[model samples]
Target: MKKTALLATAAALILSSMPLSASAAETAAYKLSIDNRTISFPDAQPYKLGSDVMLPLRQTAQALGLKVEYLPASKEAALYGPAGTAIVKSGSNQARLADGSPIEFGADAAVKSNRMFVPLSFFERALGLRTAVQEDTATAAIFTPEQTEAVVRAIVERLVAGEYQQLSDLYFDDTMKQSVPVEALKAGWEQTTATSGELTGTQVNQATSETPDQQQFVVQLSFAKAKAILSLNLNADNQVSGLWLKPIAEQAETPASLIEEEVIVGEGTKYPLPGTLTLPKGASGPLPAVVLVHGSGPNDRDETVGLAKPFRDLAWGLAEQGIAVLRYDKRTYVHGQSLTPDMLASFTVKDETIDDAVAAAKLLKADSRIDASKVYVVGHSLGGMLAPRIDADGGDFAGLAILAGSPRTLWEIIADQNAALIAAMDDGDPAKAANEALVAAEFEKALALAGLTDEEAKAQTVFGIPAYYFKEMDSRGADQIAAKLTKPVLVLQGEADVQVYADKDYVQWQEALKNNDKASFKLYPGLNHFFAKSADGKVEAQVVQDIADWINRP
Candidate 1:
């Protein structure tokens, strides 16, 4: 199959992708924080230079309570903290500590946009502060002498002791008090303990922050029946801002009747993907098979979201019914970190999902034990949206099953989702109007996608994603593609799903395929996006049975 320049630009809108440029100053890829509080850079944000975080000298030094002097003629900066005075030269990895001892940075300090940028390690090594960086989230945090792990430990102790009133009075800010009152906190704890059994113990897992003003501590709580996570949020002033307790669900055991074999999709190709092929044990004849494709983001073969492993459940459940199932890790999941900016610049849905899915389908057809004529493709979310295209792009499946997918363009659905969120917000909220205007602006950009040249699309970012990605998929609406297909299609939706609405998205699929007598649609009550009962990992057995019954029907 010939690959296109189009990539999963919609997925990039929600999932983390490599920045379009390698120049950290241009991309501002790293989020800087101090003492669990996010640090905002009004002019130049912190960026990653190799493994090191580069921060503007003056701003970072001020944030760290240090005095800084810059010598522009020689391009060097001297930082004065209580520990000592350190001198750093721009475009050099070598620096002198407060004690005049020579020190080296992981990467060279540089000047960008008239600002001298120094490695984050300078504060740690010269000023005697502690620092850590999370590469996955692109976050860098610095801890001062005033900030200690003991602070979060004390907060956890107060929570475990059930001193809601004291916690509220001493720790919670006015906003937090209104949002999570003492009574509310007590009731929440009671409800949690009642459902999850008494909290035997608690462990502070990690401390992090999303924004500049708020810090968060994730605490793991052990219960008699299950485990739960408590997210404790604090403001820069050390006041409690938010609190949430969610119980973790245990995963269902895989049945013994199923046999899983390790397989490779797109073998000997540029991007070979590892996959799992699940089949029923002791089956007598060639088995009907289906390939399971993922939605947005870098999903594992199991499509594990929180506790619900929907793809794994489907693969096991279907195998038990005498069908073989193929599920593979998404290409982005396997190779996203390794992809260069050039590779992602022209990358499209074909590169992210479709090509690998087609490869998996072909793999199934080659297996002698599998009945090639009965092979099908089951796509969830983004995968579902691109199912017909996958078929047109050489999947040539016996049938296609779409779960919780939209027939509308990806950007249209995103716009609708934002509009829905704005509608649900209080009219008096100051943020509501701002969000509305932002959505409107994004919608306008999305509208302009079709007219832009390839270079323009690649250069512009719409709705936080590369415009070219959307431009590539502009010609391939799921509904338009599905309308041209002669193969049978099964469209399943969860009525309660908030991400893809039943009335808006599912109904369109029904309308588009209405003339196809072989098309089937089913809506499950009280199910969410995963066709699971409230993300607890309990996928409706009926959903699996329905797909199996539909495929096996005469």
Candidate 2:
């Protein structure tokens, strides 16, 4: 299919998903308001259907400075605003946009006692507004663009301030109230704060739900004890229908055989990346060395994810097996926010992964304790996929070991990742189709980077990345490059890894390197993308031990 058609189809799939229903109540007890001013609905109050909040058409639109028109003969109601006009009729599930295109509503427009009631989602799309329902004072706050972030910030403040009673009373829905009582939630909050330490700061990213009227804000809170990502979803009534907090994995106890020393990659350069070097205590000179490389995202030497530190595990385990390991913090991890727009335009895999990786390898080679000819590269995920490229660029490595790598392009993996996540969710999950479209759109944007200049690339972004980044990464072929290399290759995969499936990514590696005598493959029975035993399990000892054995062999 053509790109445009593909995107359009994906978009339609996103819009067609209706929000899951909380209750089947036709009317709610909440009052309506806009911009802090209440609108008293005489004889009819705001109602809810599934995930949608329906309001009295004429008064709701007019209070927001929108011109409303109703043609009784045609049984149609229209809202006219600065951006566009929306036309909807009672009992209709489709709305006509300003461009006269039809968009499906999460719920049908309804009429009772000669008054039309329209879904808030309709106005959210056509008129670019936000709606929030608060049950405490029993008011629904219909707002404009500026209030979205502010609403989320206010809730976070309440959470941090320990105002549990007010917060629960103000925002929590029936499900939240029932599942987690006020006292229990407060205890959990206290425990989190006590365990994770005081909140240093928070970074927030917003996403609109498939219903459009609802919004979700992902807030990353930095604490002294741990870092956590909190996901908060607000319905049209501004009630927090869902909340999730995932804290970083706690670091495991230090190993006895390992001795750690701090080192810097590209030392004395503008990009001096700091890291840790792990070596077996009392080991003799000229030991085999492995430069540890991280996957995508800003990662520390440990390659910390949730509570698991796979890199640290590998480093410690390998050191126990008499190998030296060098692991460093990524460039983007330390100085990402400091980079300017122009700098990001020029940022590529070389700056992100390759150059530093090569530097680390050279650092390993220069060490008298590490055998110069026995230096190898161990890359995980994105790092794994690019290990061959790193080897080709910086020769003299003993071999390359890839863990949970994919032979496909980064964009393809991104699309697959989203699809897999959506598949894991319930079939009726409203966010599934919307997230899929978002991923598809991101890939489509990546496809356009080839013909763009530096300036153009700087102005355009895909998945929050500059087009130049994709342009550079897309040029290298991981499988093809690995196939051409003369060095021995070790491929490792986990059968239970949903992120990079064994059947697809591992199979690709096996097929691509089947003819090469030096290529070897190992598949773990129950490991995950991070080489963990289960969804939340720690890095398996066997996996790390096997890698140690592989590095030690001849």
Candidate 3:
């Protein structure tokens, strides 16, 4: 029940009886704008002709600060603008500058109702203007040369000056207005400042136009705590269409005590996963090793989520403490899309997670640098829940480390998340009641999972996933499996974690393995899901030290 890929099949069934010109309305629905102002066409409006949005040349050119002149005898039109003069002949795909340089339109320019119409590209190629056609909204925006540089600079200045409301109100397009409202923009900037400290100054590195329609600016920001980069994108209408701000990651020198090697796990098998082996540089003897497993979703060997690389941290930190760590990319992460529907219908955790982990363990055992008998498995989140099963199915680890993992069923965890969301919703909110009903329906499907046979479970979906996936895991619950195992176990949890509750999941693991003297538990205060002090996502150094100490304990 972890995050699985949603396969979508789209079929276009065309009937002979259907009208060929059914899209005519959509073709003529385009609204043309110049310099952020919509142009009204008294004689000829914009229309699509063979994949190009054709606009009346006379009006469109004049709107873009160009003078239009027609030659009746030769059936040619001349557009004179600041850039140069362009000559276009009716029913021709080629245009020429006054200097006689020919430019291809990619489509023919034609005369309709006594008005010469040209493709949208003509404005960009011939007149040297920027243009964009938004197919979703059926609108095209054209920008004159004078509008690009000054507008981009002004936007950056206004943003750093904290003019979110004015930017949202005046410059934002319809899509940007909805996605990043004034409050959202303000909150994002505030969060950036909160992390990077006070905004000291700003420098605009460069403004570039990769495509004819969009202009991108890379700005360097100086903050009290850290320097960051802000990337701003603008549409042809000079609207703020996209924005991103991220702190520059600090570069740390690699420790000389540790060494790394590129290796492949499950080599010559069905899904060979590439991985990294971090080892103590000057080890005199075989060292104890740990195989790092990932949580839900397709994750790389680094287990990078946003900016955090917990697996890499563990590998490096533990190696610095004289412990070797092997981490590999998940199979689903590498081959999720290639897996067909038949493969997914019968897919379980063993195929998604356990098999790769066991392969990694076997790989460690075979390595000459590794101490085979002292090899351990460290699982995080979903990996944590399946640690016992991974050990049972040929991992044969000396110990197990479960980090931020729960003993509950995956569906039960999902149900808990949904219930918590419902509890937090306002009673009178319109979406609250509807979401409640939806959650209730999914809960019923989850409860009905155990009663159905494998064939029936595979046939029906619960919460948009095959019920058989959950049914398979239900029979081999991690708590039950770990309870029966006498292997040394270390359970670590973050007190501030909202995803898996300490009171419920952490307590349950302790209760399940209470009789085993080898079982140990530790809860971190003020740490979130990744066991970091703040949301910045780097795991606390003490946590790694604790793990290394536990592995090397006498």
Candidate 4:
């Protein structure tokens, strides 16, 4: 059949493909950009098929925000985009998108390096996504979801295996190769492996500046003894220009005066959250209790990020001072993502934050070891903003403690954080432009949400969350809610926290609650958002002591 002959021809060309030489391929890298931001690919390099650029299939779909499912039985792959679906068969140049849109490609889909390869033109024609390839710098400012995973996997495997020479040859640029000698890299890997144990798994914590020309991937590699972050910053030439490891800070020695317990929060709920309860070791009577709440994101009870665990530090440090403390994993942290589309559509802060916190407080109040009359809530960042809402929902807390709390709208806070992060980046840094583009996109999404009806918002997603969630949050003003609460309030602000500006957020809190005599505020001069000691790079002991004193005060 003529079809069989076409397939054979495509196969013959691919089988004869040769590896690109370093000298010839030095500037042969390709860049992919979607919505004007660069997307970086680490493992699968782009190659040309005549005049068209080709990419690994799965990665390309992911970059385009499409979900892919391969049917081994049929030798077919289905890509589901937000708007439609596309189907491609192996060894065929024919494909179809949703609505029966036909695609005739010059090259047939084939398997290579254990991945499916397809032309970028398929996405451009079928999904209406924009893509470009820059052969000059071997850059593509385009991103697909799969490329990120592949890159992270490749880097983590190489680092853990202690393949320093290969890494230098494959990933490092001229400056990086000169700076990180192979012996030094090998010794570093040996020390890290010996300390952390054999590599078990890796998770991509974050990806930023995903333009086709450059990218930064932060990965959390779990080892037997501990976890460490391997951050890779790649340049236009697809070389590792910057590389570093960030390990979790060791917890300060637990004082003899304190004890920590693992417990469950909201036990009867659909998802019973796990938590840590810290109390004085030898308490003979009921002790005052404070329940710690995390800021935004899927945070553990410790609110672990990078090398910091602010909540854990707070829990043990306060318990050492004779105060009982409780901190639980966020709902979204455990059950938020597993929910069905319908469930997520209706998700809001009420379920994500307020409910579990109220449950924790009720549990604490009922505990024989806790003084029900003195139960308080300590909310940091997003938690702090919702403290009043928690109380209004019958937390019946004795008081509220606000740390790095923002009185501004949640979206405003997010925008400010994005702006600050972008400002901190250096000029001409490719990441800066990409991040700025992301910020612009987020703002556009937020603006679109402002006009949607509540019902419509429920059916949509913004910044990767259900738009209804934002609608519900924007409907309630934490500052207004806090102003009406009669409970004693303690507000703590870090003057140096650019994430939540002290001059803006702290000042707004003081002004809003000035009429409420039960409210008080404390401002630390040099502390950052996490209350870490800027000089020593750990959560300051004094900050913990201050919270304990504020709670213990008559």
Candidate 5:
């Protein structure tokens, strides 16, 4: 039982998988020694080790002479030539050919020079050919004529017999890639063995996306037994370029605590913008309540992704903690195409956020169980950023719990921040590849036009959008709204958050609230911007993901 097994000839039937170490067929591990000295900085990890073939896919595919056509209409690719054809769906395994039968193989397919290339071995197997893998060359030569015929014959025989729903030897191919070492996956496999079925399942769903050169399939398969989502990237060459297996249990829906009543915000002509209302169990009488505002984007109340729901967690967590929560879907989710960040400036303070929240607040205030004067605003992220404007008009809210709110005008803060990101570089110095002088010139030109009147601003470009409304944003600060405020303002910051650091917004609040000592500030030590704690809990980590359940709002 060696890791590499000889293909069954048209004469016999056998399926054998041996360990990589014991397999005589194993080639010395390939290391992408593209020194990348200038590109790979000293502090940078040399390379993402393992089977991430960073090499150009087009070069390899052309060497093999495969006809690669990335079909966008079906979101699957058709690859054929000297080797048999394979149909690759975005995010799924590479399809194989066994006469009328098909054998599937897993390897990543990516594009290069406007052409598709696949992982060497995967390309071979999908075409029913025998493969010779060479680590030093990071190449797998094909022996198609004899082996493919035999493979097709053997595969057909196996399908007829139904020996197994799928072939196994999954680890051997991975061992060669060296990206995610086999050890971690083995550990995960063993630890979740008992609970695998509940966590993972496989689906035949196919999705596709256009990369630089060719279109690719984004396939989503569930390893139900493992409770994981396995995403495969199949390029036009029918080779897999990316394979991601993420845990599924972490995505299960938490049963929401039953309370009383949920609300429906406007159903945009496009999608449902339903909202939820949570009340504490029992008791009675008017309770002090707060309206929950979402951050930027067309996020659902829960901000759904595959398995995590941060907003839902927040709403439910707070509701169970005694505070009533009212939150709704963002316009983006409701009216997908009608609204976008590009037109955000066109949306006045009221049409976008304020009016809906105020309407909800007013509605809540009318509710016999909610105290009108005691109503507060709990705004997260962009919600926190926009809170001052809403509070400026709401008049009735007693205070605001601003979470990760940015005090600086968004345009300036965002520009300075992007400048830093675009400036800093490490790998091949991930630094900005764009011409800085050009960008600076554009910036200066844009800002000069920023001084224009509203009508004039509409005529000039600022940050890819019109500059008219944006100039006003530069002069407007959160402190201005706070200056008019006469209530308790609790500024909440996650110490590890970089997006809206405690130093930036908190200090701004402290200085702005000097005359209004009623403004209180607290930092969540371990939390990121999302109030979630993690060493990696910075800008990217804080994105809200709502996945499943009877619970979250997304």
Candidate 6:
């Protein structure tokens, strides 16, 4: 299976049975380009089947339109455009685009999903994307419109809210009238602690005056238990003018020091996975190990996107409490190689995510300091759905803790995903027609294959299954295997997580585990998918910050 790790095998065998000569195998290769520079793929002889040629996906898809990103570890990606965002990936390619329906690029490529797969030339021509033949290099210019008063306010709010590290990437060089580096904000981050505003407000009025070319808005901020205000300056375009320095009223939670020792876990391994294993300061014997699996989006070890570092905070806090914690660098962030969108369609559950989880679980089990029998898995969001199957894999694990998991097929989940995301947006209009049409088409595809139904026209699903419902179905026998789940399960639900709401999904879980008694479910009254407390499930709830509400350290 290791050498067979090539991606195309699952559906590829169904594609071309023709045995091409070795020379033709060499000719039908792919190359990746970034701003006319080569990133991953190159002019090599004999391209292996099913390899992903990851240049920036955006540069390959038509510009500023809906784009897709892949996170191999999580086994997912994000698709966003004027419509909304859909999570795309190798197995579950459900994210749909605007007028950009899934279509084939030619015999050389096809879109078995919303993800577009193209020959090397498509990348070169589509987005001015190109790779250098002379050297292994990547080059791309990020374009941004000038920041407005609205944009700057939003940026400072995020900075004040601990959602972003820097605003530089958000805007273009031409639009950056002025700005401040992170160093200048150290003092600001130190102040504002213990202030009532530190818990409820972002009004950091530290700097009242503006430099000759700037205006400042200091926002109160908190992270890692430290609280402070962010001083943002305004430029002529109403963009960020510059960064300001302000003395601190108090510094509540400063890192012990920035000089942290970088420990490389897999010392001699190439492409060694990145992660941190935190063991309690004092443990008498081998302790229970918990692997913190991330949610849907491309995330870092911290799971820091938007205001969701709950995973990182949990890892550190729990490890301190005697439970060992393990979290890894998501494939998307690992940065060097990315699975191209083209290769994603043929994906299945085992091909993308399960293997990585399996590898990590085994890696931790082998450690002398860990109790293999007590190895546990705690998955949040999409990882939650994946946990049961992981348990079904016959691994050495204590149990599963699902933070907002689902029991329905990912295909049905996509329909719900579309409804939820669109409802949360300002547009407020349901793209129901588009969603329905896609469902119908998928069911027809299935009916044609199974020959089990003649009512294809009115069929959105068959036998309780929706079209494309199993678009990424691997483990077709999971429900059959559930009869064997003797371990305990903790289902943590957030009443406000409409995207994967407990009422719909948790009920499905309840039914599937029907007569089983080893299960427990807890619904956090006001939490959302991010596990952040909220009144109703809405995108805005994620933006409102609360320190360590959904997670508690060991």
Which regions of candidate 2 are displaced past 4 Å? 1-248, 251-253, 425-436, 447-456
Give residue 264's lDDT in candidate 1 (0 to 100): 88
Better of 4 and 5 by lDDT: 4
lDDT of each: 0.76, 0.74, 0.77, 0.72, 0.50, 0.47
Q: Global CA lDDT of candidate 6, please?
A: 0.47
What would the TM-scores of all predictions be?
A: 0.63, 0.59, 0.59, 0.60, 0.51, 0.48
lDDT of 6 at 386: 78
Which candidate, 2 or 4, would have the higher TM-score against the true structure?
A: 4
Cα lDDT tens digits for candidate 6, 1-554: 01000111111111112122221122234444323233342222113233323222333442333345454465444444333333333322233233434322112432322332333322222222211221233222222122223455577555456543344445313223111223223223333222224444444452433222234466654444434345565542344534432223221241232111233334454435677776666566887777777665445666653333666566655565566777786554463233432333333455444555666788788889888887888877767777877776744567877777777656556556544433443443243344345445544554353443323312434322332224435234344444457767767777877668777887767776676687666776777776665321122233212112222222
The top-ranked prediction according to TM-score is 1
Superposed by TM-score, candidate 2 places the C-alpha of residue 103 at a distance from the truth, in angstroms, of 50
Off by over 4 Å in 6: 1-271, 335-337, 421-470, 474-480, 534-554
Task: Give the clash count for model 6.
Answer: 19
**Colliding pairs, model 2:** 132-237, 132-238, 133-237, 133-238, 249-306, 249-307
The top-ranked prediction according to lDDT is 3
Question: Tens digit of lDDT per residue, candidate 1, span 441-487?
Answer: 88999999999999988887676667788889877878888887777
CA shift of 265, model 5, Å: 2.5
Per-residue alpha-carbon lDDT of model 4 for 386-438, expressed as tens digits?
Answer: 98888889788899999998777887777776676567666876656765776
Ranking by lDDT: 3, 1, 2, 4, 5, 6
Q: Tell me the spans in candidate 5 whose CA falls farther than 4 Å from its real position.
A: 1-260, 266-272, 304-308, 340-345, 427-446, 459-461, 465-476, 535-554
Candidate 5 per-residue lDDT over residues 456-528, each given as its tens digit: 6655555444465456555445778777777777777778776676777768877776777667666667776
In candidate 1, how many Å is residue 5 off? Answer: 42
